[model samples]
Target: MARSSRSSAPEPTQGRFRRILGKTITYGLILALLVALGVAVAVAAAVRNLPSFEELRRSPTAQTIRLRDVNGTVIVSIGPNYGRWLKVSETPAVMRDAMVAVEDRRFRYHFGVDPIGLARSVKVAFERRGTGRRLQGASTISQQLARNVFLSNNYSMARKAREAILAMALEWKFSKDEILELYLNKVYFGGGSYGVDAASRTFFGHGAEELSLSEAAIIAGLVKAPSRYSPTADAQAAVGRANVVLDVMVDAGVITPAQRASAAPAEVRLASEPNQNSARYFTDWAIPQLDALIDESVEPLDVWTTLDLDMQRTATASIQSNTPEGAQAALVALDRDGAVRAMVGGRDYVSSNYNRATKAERQPGSAWKLFVYMAALESGYKVDDEVVDEPVTINGWTPRNSNGRFSGTIDLRTAFAYSVNTVAAKLGDSIGYSTVANMARRFGITSELNTQPSMVLGTADVRVIDLTAAFAAVSAGGKSIQPYGITKVSTAEGRTLYERAPPPQNILVDAWVAAGITDLLQTAVNTGTGRAAQIGRPVAGKTGTTSSNKDGWFLGFSSGLTTGVWMGRDDARPVTGLQGGAAPARAFADFMRVAVANRPVEEFTTQVELPQWQLESDEEAYYGDPSLEAQFVDENGQPIELDPAQPGPQPRDTPGDGPGPDTADKPRLDRRWIDEVTGSGGDNGNRATGQRGSGQGGP
Candidate 1:
């Protein structure tokens, strides 16, 4: 065929081949250069945003709130725990080699990224592409450190470029040991632990410097998947993973086969689980109180609390042993100055974080009688004052004793000993509910109270801590106290940041009243309902059982320690055969039996003398004049209002206008009832002993 003028004659085959080859080489080189330029620009952009090498080398450690007991023993750490930063030289050689062997054998030679490993991974992925196998990541230790410290795991080309650039920068500015040290201290291990030292301490119950070969291997294996390989989560899987790490160590020539064979599964012993729940409830309660003491925002604190670790252990054991199955119990014990010595908020803190002692507000039941008797005593009523404990109804609400019967015309001390609800109700009706509530407030009862007659029978909901603190006041010889836990707060370097000052010693009740109430509580524990709490020593306490057996409580003091215990279901469901004297009282006894063993025995004392007593006719004594409405007056005998600083429900606009028990059917008082109610009385028991540090007048 003839060639057209526009087309040249058929070119030589050799010429055509050479022309194609030249064009191919030229175009390929141009594309390659363009790609290289783009990569260089991306690298430059990433490297420019990175922080200085000095800043990167610091390896910031996460701070956490650490709590210590009175003995300075660690109670708990509230956040991710980071031990002291460990240098590469400080880390055991076995641990270092294991990490390098399993994570990146080429770590010693690679500048930052391992191209040969990446190529190998890519080849393997391509070979298994149709087999549903995923692409393996060839990121070296440096790349991991870069991503973890300065970048995010975004899985984008830009992020990879930044990570690679940052890794290179780390290598360029720091030595190989410094880079490894930063990585070792910055990587997160399992179980809320950060850094290699923390991991070693957590897993091996020792420091990173003390790690053995097997333990080191196990810890190194956790870097890939912490939760999956955590020894605490799966010991067998972790040991298997550690065996794989040993194999890699052997292949990398970091360890000989004979050495690997010696590191058996049995040699990989994990540390026993820590006492995390030992006092978790107490720490939870003490955490919020930090905001008031220090600038927690500036740095973490090491709170030196008032918790007696031994007593706390005993209290937890007592509650766990005595509390009925399917029910929960809370206990709070305080020193004379209101320092919380030991506290257990529930049966199991993990199963339920609800702090029953500090948070739950349930009826105090007969334990409410502490305020009733205290108010009556402060109002001039004696422990020996005669009161009728009969089937009495006021405002249509009849306060029945737990025994369903009464002692009928019993002394106040006797009735209190047996926890007579009828006598408490009559006192509430005669003294006025507001007076009782104010008395509770004076003693630091900071719960909302119902000022009705039933409230006198312990019908108001109150926190265990508040009620315990109130009783602590009586135990402190009428000196009111604010319950506290944290004694001092300091920084990690032992710099005192905040220390608790001595709480104000505000007198809540009269010494005579305190002595009188002590007499009543002594009677209750010695020969009455609280008998179960008797530790064969001088113990005085009260027992309370709510309606339908919904709640049970025992509060008392002995040898300068006051404690309160409450037992019931969280749902407020009735527990059959449950009563304050049975479970709570026994728990108190079991706890006190050990808690106060070292404390010296102190006999209770009184300064006031009781007047001559006589029983009156049922007509005149049982039914007081209906015209006389109950009144509460201050020291001047004038009417008073509720103190706003105290935590309690304000009285109704009409003080005695609530749905209280009818007065007509209640006790009949003498003409001098108001004036005579304030008469002081003597304690029937030993009344000449000294109080704590007084050598006279024991509470």
Candidate 2:
């Protein structure tokens, strides 16, 4: 009886224990369901803002403006330069296999988020918790694409949830091949490049369609850390990373061990590093102008610029070699039609991208006098007419010459050649400062002019490009021009988008006025402050030096090129003994000597013959003397009377007199060899047309 009772008691105890176990199981199941529901809600909330499939598919890639020289050589790329967009069928089998093996071994089986990879990554994190190693991520190719394209790389649970949700959405909306294509086409490579084709071109000098197995492996390995494995950054590290990719490919059964062995040596040959980055100054200036031509809907563009690569190199070297220490120098050279051929913004673009050539506004000093002299010439003043160089005052502002003591009563040519401030001030005052400012505007000087008497002495700030264009107009025999850099803009497939229109041959000044100013410029270069700029040719130029030598400038035209150089401290601090005739003129001569070596020497137009005027009486009339009137004689020495009411020797050619036939013969550069080498069928791969502007270097 006692044994039976003990057994019954144990049965009841066992039954009680079973009831407690059942309750524990029910609570655990309820808690697990609630947690799962919470997680589902959080994921749903995180992904509510996700982009739709069509929006994601149509997401814009970083479009680049690839700048090319006149000869079709690439100058530089602006923005993240992407290569050709490729499809899965177009991708090489070897490249695909290598990329899959290295980036995501289970890329084919993953439904978007790879649970196996996540589990393994978790195990590793726990194993190395105290090792001070960075926690690794197990992002599938789809997850990576989602993060790269749609999500930021914030390390948070919400980001991870969104990434996973987006990955799944991508898998649902796109086929595996489409996902792979997007990933390969959108992946980031180093050196401001993106995508397989761009990366291949950047690293191997070819496209992804032609990638070798080893090259494919090398590029595939860059996904881990692009900068770390970039061949340009470190060749040895790149080789090691590529070998690792080959080993992974072998393990994944994509490539055999034999194939891996052959590619293990990583006999990868990288393309030569681009040495044309020195042209960034030109690219920087030309890129903003590109937006005005094409809209965002257009494909990536190949911009054919007006730059002469050889001339650009020479200008850069000359500027770098001639620029003074602790000071910056900028140079802008234009063709006769005002096409920018060469520009150097500063001593070193790496140190500063300030773009002094196009952006810096510095006082042009005597270079500003080009307008004053043109005004004088347009007002019927002869180049040989006499002007007193004594100190002059206008509007209670007294102006002194740079030498502080000017020669008494010198011819206009002598006064101009010497850059005498007193004569320039007097000329501006007599012609009405407004007239001088208007003259500058007519010649394409876009900067605001002070219109004060000091403006005649170049107190106004101006861009080097504008000043250079102004000089180019004078060299073009008074035809106005707008400075331009791009000649053609087209897509990679050779569809032309924007082509620079031929410059209008608008006559800004009379031919006689241009000739008279040219005569003065020639005298300056021959026997005056700009004598150092003599390049053994008939050069016509002017020199400008601001007060205390804060700014120096040399502007001139020769061999059908108008170039301007400016040298000064960026802070406007004075540079010791920095006159326009010193470094700026020497640099101009140095650059021009080589830039125009092949071109035939061209001479300035003949100076217009003017009647000998009575200088004393003319001066009296210029000073507003009502009693005495100026007298003039014809070239035949016949006495003539001047009209006080009517100014200037003759009326300027009206707009109806279309360009007046002083146009020089435009020379087109022969690009037969360039076509043969580029296989561009004479269009330079961008279908560029109409040659470079009208005169000197072109095509």
Candidate 3:
């Protein structure tokens, strides 16, 4: 009975131990299941808040607008938001290797996130949490791309979890090369540059495929902190970063130790600074037109413009060197077809954005004489016809020559060459002011013209561009011109958005009229007021100085090109000693000297024949008229006969009371010519004309 009792007690103790062990195992399993469930819930929640992978894949990237010169050299870039897009095939292997070495050394072996790197980051975070130091991120290339494209850069557990989930999704959807390509294009480099392509061009002045090992390393180092690592900003730090990348590349067996060493000390030749070209005036002028050419739905464009950068430099230098103190200058050059080649809007575009070439409306002064003379030629008036330069008055306003001394009875050609004020005024009054205004309009003068007689003297304001275009008509043999700059616009993918075709030729002036005027202007440039503007070529130009010397103008053209230069104070105050024949003419000459150096010299076409009337004397043509006493007038406002027998000034016949001269015997003038001479040809010899100076006279 005692053996039975001891055995039964041992069995009870054994049963209790077994039961306690079983309960302990059960509770442990329950706790493990709960923790696993909680982790799954957190991960699921993070995934739900992340952007959809398909949406991110389909999103459009911002683009840049590149403007190129006529020679296809990039002058400036407009929008640099996402920079230029480059495919994976376009990226050089060395550049890609450098990026991987610096950014994610284990990028090839890692799934999406580097678990070993994350572990180290976690340990470091805990150590530095209380030390006021920033915690390092453990993002692989895929993780970085996921965050950059589909998630914010917010540092939080939730954001980190979302990044991991999106990274894994990207790994599942794309190849390693695809992920790397997207990461490179989406990454931001400093200086308003994004993507490997843009960054390569911005730093090396070359494409990504042309990047040297040293350049690749430097560019790769910039990924960590673009502005901070930018060589332009901090060369020493950027080089240090590049050396670290080179060592990593060596460690990864991507490059030899010798290559790393060679690359580490290589000098980084960064690209030249942008906006160094003097094309801002043209770019600013073209901005509005560029915008109009592109549609909103189209991607960013590449515009090819008609700017000759070399000529632009020449134009800018000429204007800057010749502009006088306290004065501003503007210039515009156009090809024969009216392509704006070079334009300098002011002395310095930085100091002032006011484009004088296209904007300013100042009096053209005697440059306006081109239209008046054109009117006379069209009116059957000969350039060599006699016109008295003596002082004249009409309705109490007297006109005087620039020298303040009249050279009586000068030919129209000599009068125009010297900018003789009295002759031009009398011609305007005789032909009527309306005739001169109409001629100006016919020649592309868009400015409003005052009907007063002074309008012929260029008292009316006009734009420099319009005046330049009008001169282009004579250079182009009477064809009207509209100045244009852009030639073509296309997307980066080579899709044509706009292309300019040759504009139709529109004739604005008669060929004979243009030829006649071109001849007279050539004489002016060769032997007259515009003599300073001669470029050792057959150039035709006119010189003008406004009242008080407020504005000086030189409008000239060659057979190949036309250019206009204007010098004046912006405030319209007079510039002392400034004349169109001086600085303005010299500026024109300097610019043309460089512009035409490479072009073949050509002479002006002489297409017009001299009129028979111009070849004969007035005495032989009208000597035998019965009413010669009523037909001709002298300087004293008295009728005179062709014969000396009736030379004494005779009283005028009563109005319409006598038989007029036989029409056949009289050398009949066109009614327009008759009215012109009969109304204003007679001179008032005793009138006092106004003060005048060199090159300061009527057109």
lDDT of 2 by residue, 415-455 (tens): 77778788888898888899999998888777777777788
Where does candidate 2 have its weakest 10-residue lDDT segment?
Answer: 690-699
Best-to-worst TM-score order: 2, 1, 3
Worst 10 residues of 3 by lDDT: 684-693
TM-score of each: 0.55, 0.56, 0.55
RMSDs, each prediction? 18.0, 21.0, 21.8
Task: Name model 1 segments beyond 4 Å from true.
Answer: 1-62, 78-275, 296-300, 609-683, 686-699
Model 3, position 643, has a per-residue lDDT of 46
User: Per-residue lDDT for 214-279 in model 3, tens only?
Assistant: 888888989888756787655777888888888889998899988877774348777665444458
Off by over 4 Å in 2: 1-60, 77-276, 296-298, 609-699
User: What residue pairs clash in candidate 2, if any at all?
Assistant: 692-699
